[model samples]
Target chain A: MGKRRTGTPTLEEVAAHAGVGRGTVSRVINNAAGVKESTRRTVQQAIEELGYVPNLAARSLAGRRADAVALVLTEPDWRQFAEPFFSEIVRSLGDALVDTGMQLLLTLVRSEGERQRFLEYARGGRVDGILLISVHAGDRLPDMLAEARLPTVLLGRRSGDEYVSYVDADNAGGARTAVAHLLERGRKTIATITGPLDMYAAQSRLRGYQDALALAGLRGTRSLVAEGDFTEESGRRAMAELLERHPEIDGVLAASDTTAVGALHALRAAGRRVPEDVAVIGFDDFPLAQSTKPRLTTVRQPLEEIGRAMVRLLIEEMEEPAVAWRHVILRTELVVRESS
Target chain B: MGKRRTGTPTLEEVAAHAGVGRGTVSRVINNAAGVKESTRRTVQQAIEELGYVPNLAARSLAGRRADAVALVLTEPDWRQFAEPFFSEIVRSLGDALVDTGMQLLLTLVRSEGERQRFLEYARGGRVDGILLISVHAGDRLPDMLAEARLPTVLLGRRSGDEYVSYVDADNAGGARTAVAHLLERGRKTIATITGPLDMYAAQSRLRGYQDALALAGLRGTRSLVAEGDFTEESGRRAMAELLERHPEIDGVLAASDTTAVGALHALRAAGRRVPEDVAVIGFDDFPLAQSTKPRLTTVRQPLEEIGRAMVRLLIEEMEEPAVAWRHVILRTELVVRESS
Candidate 1:
């Protein structure tokens, strides 16, 4: 990991071979940039001929590229990490970038101060590009970044339509499929537990459920519905509330795996057997799906695909700014286990 | 976000403030090596005042840092993301770096080629540093990274005196506390379902169990020990094995929350009531710990703290290379719930 090579090739030697500046030679080898046309080629050629591998430890002393990227989470609660969706997405993103010879940086922003500071840093060229995850609606970060026009990709779409690129799962379609499955199962007493509706994801999922129910000629039933904030407790509370309100409920749909977990707990506590007494289905096929006594019958969003798609979109936009902003929606598969 | 205060600030402001040549300003800001020391400072001061952030987004333009860090997870299974450990560590690491004005980049390198490519990207200045997690003993990536002298901080350490930095929990102490509590409860025929022992964390936990047994003059019995890989399915399998080997075992200890969940399933499947016929304890009190039927008595590693520590150490090392290689060991607490 150094500038050492056979024949003691100078920066000049490398530049001459690659037809670029000594600086360009340094930049490309160090994965830094700013060198002009044909410069990178010359430098790369020189390095290949001389078999020169840039030494990271020695590079700091040479006053060159630090060669690092930071990954910002932009979330606060520590418990948020336990969410399988987040971890799985990060894993896939990291794997893809690593193959590209890039590093994965992780950061979490809980407040406006941190957000501003991070934006400043990004503007300061502290990062090559940013991979952002924004949970709440109406967060003004996307526009700020867009105006800056930094190479940034978001986990979710901005609330409004100012130019930006993003990758998201087919949350609505997955929910519709989930609801359709329940309808096909012919559980007349269908019910639903939704996540925080403020989130576009939650809203899309809710819409999917409604569309499916409407197709089956079953209208929305308030007594058979409850709102959860995507936690097991909320799911449990919602399920218990549903049971209290409609004891005859035989089919249930939850927005997430955690909520479904809560549904399982509530149903079990109430002495209701799954699928037999009250059928259950969940989304996100989180790790918990299999551990439950009656394994969860759920929908699996292609997490790796989501991550790769986000990176792909970001890189595409970064390469060609004139390209129109794109929205990528991947499909989801319903995985049936014992519960349903 | 307005275009008036555009991302590319005035270079004249930088020149005026730095009190250097327009040529020197070009050299320093563009990262040319010929700029003198004093000239560099002036240009830097000017650049800072004008808020002249460098541009990395342009397809052809190049200068400045990547502003991201790569978090490498050595785990092979993508589904393992459901485990809270991956999420908690990632979130904490992300939180710590957010305000440090760095973007977070995350990657998973499960194969040799991928690991090599990541190392290349990192050494190539694609990232600033790396924070790694859940690496196994047999994996060569850790050793390769260390040999390359890449700036890396691990969530847990491997065997031997490698010079890499890390932040980890006091697994041994935590295990001792859990086991000691079980012993104090007067439950004999104790059994333990441990994570893969090849991992240093797992080994330390096993040592804790042995230490506790010895303190109580109870020789550690192989018959009561079964191995798990820190998943619910593994715990269930181990529990079943332990039951077959030691039918009269009345107490159980699991290395992780998932394992404990599996043990609960196994106990119930065998018609053994929790805390009545057999008591159990688990580790890493994830949110699910509270939701477990009888709840779960588990060890709570300051997962967030470890994340913070890893980032802190890596940043400190970056700022000052003279800092001693540190092994930051955080505390772990035993949170008792109904299972015990």
Candidate 2:
């Protein structure tokens, strides 16, 4: 093996050493397909031996893609940043991009000033595209990126009429399934603890709950619903309020697993035994669901599939630049456990 | 507000619109100091109004920094990616970089081939610096990065004799404090479940356990120690084996919170009453600590402080490449709860 040279080696030297053309070396360096495996290995060996480092900055300036994507968090709440839900999404997205040779840049935009700063960063050609997660209704960052001609994909939509490309789990369908399962267990009087209604996912979940009750020929009264922010505290508060107002309720559906955990605490405090007095179900089968007392029956979102679909759509839009905006919805399943 | 023009706008056009000099606009765009706050706001307003996007690629080709940092994960185990430890580090790092106008790029290098590709990417100047986490002993990527003259910082050291800059907690001291607490609680016959010894953190923790026992004038026999890999399953297995081998053990020290939870499970299965028949302590007072059956008494590392120190050191090194490498060790405190 040759010792590393004090001076940098050029592409031509690596090509000559590998006994291949300069183009072959360049293709191998860029990770472009079509190069023979054996030839690629030979060129990589020569490059390693000579310590030849390609100038990505120069390649990018010469009209080549940066081969990077930005996963920007648009939520203003810092607490959400530490949630397991966020971690799951990031893990899945990182796994999805591992083989694409594109780096994932994580950004947090909490305020309008930071949003403008990120817009400039994205438009500056530092990334091939952008992936926005946790975007709330009325957020204009997505439209701004679209106007700037940057390929952008979102993890969830702001509304049903979202124009930007997005990949979302079937929130309504998942909620409907959860409620239907409760009905099948012979629970006639049911109530719901919903997430903050500003988000479309929360709205869809509420709609699903209402639709399930209607389908069962049960009247979903106004007193049967309470609002939560998908937080444990909110869930507890909502559950307590529902218990106080409607003591006859025998079934409860929480919009999120965290909320369900809170409701469990409230039920225990109120002297209600799970599945005996009041059966419950939650959404987003988080890891915490399995650890709760009596466990939790919840709706499981296909998070990994959602992450992969978002990446695929973004890459397609980046390559074509004129591809129509797409909306892909993945299915969710019910994971039954002790609570339900 | 003026409508966005069809053609791309230049820096000169932005300066003309803001009624400022081209150099003034350039300084504002680069986020360099010396421009008045009012002038900076005016230039920003003009840039946003005209939809002017700076070319970061050309700026990099001109020898300017990319103003981005890479947070690389060298761990090959995919399961670790979803751990709360990883999420906390990423959240803190992102928060640290938010006001600095530097984006955080996340990369996972699991295989040797990916390591070589990352080397070329770093050498190509895609980022200003690197922050590595979960590096195992004898990992050569850090040294390779150092040889390439990149500003790098590690969350934890590969070994005590690490030459690269890093920020680590007082792992040994934390462990010693935990064991000392157990001793002070009048518990003799104590045993320890150690983390994988290959990791410096784990080794230090084990050393601390032995030192505490020796200081207390008790024999730290080999039979009182079992090794684990910081996973819940490993912890459960190690604790079960220790119980079977030495049923007289009255107290236990687990290397991590997850491990402690597993120990709790094992103790429960064996019908050992905590703090009565047996007591347990854990490290890394993670969120899981507070929610455990009896709640967990564990050591709390200053994770946020460690993150801020790492970012500060990396920025200093990037600004002055000649700066001497510095090692930062933050203090840890013990949080006592019902478990102990």
In lDDT terms, how accurate is model 1? 0.76
Residues B34-135, model 2: lDDT tens digits: 999999999999998987888788778785578888999887875566556776777788778887878777776877977987887888889889999999
Predicted structure with the largest DockQ when compared to the true one? 2
Native-referenced DockQ of model 1: 0.30
Superposition error at A154 for model 1 (Å)? 3.7
Interface RMSD per candidate: 7.1, 2.8
Over the stretch A1-340, how does candidate 2's per-residue lDDT look in tens digits?
Answer: 7987533577888999999999999999878999999999999999989888876777787855788889988878655555568777887897899889787777778778778888877888888999999989989999999988899999889999998999999999998888999999999889999988899999999999999999988879988999998888899999999999999989999999989999999999999999899999989988889999989999998888988999999998998874698889999999999998
Mind sharing the TM-score for model 1? 0.75
Query: What local lDDT score does residue B307 receive in model 2, on the 0 to 100 scale?
Result: 86
How far residue A141's Cα lies from its native spot in candidate 2, in Å, is 3.2
Proportion of true inter-chain contacts also present in candidate 2? 0.67
**What docking class should model 1 receive?**
acceptable
Residue lDDT tens for model 1, A1-340: 8965432345567677766667667678667757665766656667878656554334432442233345566656656565666767777787667555445656656678877867766665545567777456767777787777776677766453535777778888999998899889888888889988767788888888888888989898767668998888899999999999999999898999989999999999999999899899999987779998799999898888888887777667656653577788789999999898
